[model samples]
Target: MEYQYKEVRRELAARADTVIWLDHPFATVMTRLVRRTVRRRAGRVELWNGNQESSLWSVFTDPEHILRWGWKSYGRNRARVRALVGQVVVVRLSGQGQVERWLTGPLAAVGEERAR
Candidate 1:
């Protein structure tokens, strides 16, 4: 469930028992975005609606380019997720290490619970 609007996310969070927020740093987000976009472009992957990644140069020229969009929305997204902390159970993972730990610990427990 990837949501762009804060209102939608808030509504979804209200229904979910827990919401995992990846609070990665801007640099980390940009690096991953670059790698993903390059890989998609090189592989000629077809994204939704038969759309493929635009030229890498578009990052500089296109304000709506995925990379630029990610960069521009990062702060607002962070703030939106932060505001949901008390309203819902938010497990914010700030780094890869935290993410891995949650996967093996809390998340695994939830999975195991469902299996029983």
Candidate 2:
């Protein structure tokens, strides 16, 4: 639950250990290995930085089936990401304060990876 100022995005970009992926896409499929909820739903939820998650009606507009895709991969993604991000510093934070600290602390470095 750490959040860094947008300015920090630049700092992280300079770090070698940091990886930034924009316009990236993936799907979540439920399988025997990944037993999770399959809810075909989307809503216009507010996000940080004055953003909206997405309107529920958009599900029909996007061919990617954003909501359905995400619902399928709920549990599997975390495990996949953790394995993919090996050899990097991982911090499991459970609150927003930790995010504040990282933004003001060592996490300012670009390319540095920390998990919460």
Candidate 3:
């Protein structure tokens, strides 16, 4: 959605009044990904298409490993979202607390405006 469908993304953003960017820290994100992966693998959680998390060793070996992807793309994703600053009304929420605040505050205001 970010690189391939430029026109479609632009149209979607233009149609929407605001975009919320969750710009969590790299360490925070990586930690969460690691923990989630561990939990999923331990539980053998089934996901879409009946897929399950692979061995923990695959984290270092597999090219398509989600943890690896997250580590590699975190900075790029942040930059990509930041680049949308001038293109849309971006509300960047840094952490869970900020997101909760947004859900209760500015987001409510947007709903109220829509109601008006």
Best lDDT among the predictions, by candidate number: 1
Q: What does candidate 2 score on TM? A: 0.34
A best-first ranking of the candidates according to their lDDT comes to 1, 3, 2
- Give the top-scoring candidate (TM-score): 1
What digit string (tens of lDDT, one per residue) describes model 1 on residues 1-116? 66566557657776877778888888899999999999999999999999999998988899899988998899988887787778778888998899888889856988999999
Error of 3 at 39 (Å): 0.7
Worst 10 residues of 1 by lDDT: 1-10
Query: Per-residue lDDT of 1-116 in model 3, one digit per residue for the tens?
Result: 34324457667766766678887878889999999999999999997799998888998799879888888888877776677788778888998899888889856988889999
* C-alpha positional error of residue 32 in candidate 2 after TM-score superposition, expressed in Å: 28
Q: How far is candidate 3 from the true structure (C-alpha RMSD, Å)?
A: 3.7
Q: Which TM-score value belongs to model 3?
A: 0.78
Instruction: Return the lDDT, model 1, position 14.
Output: 67
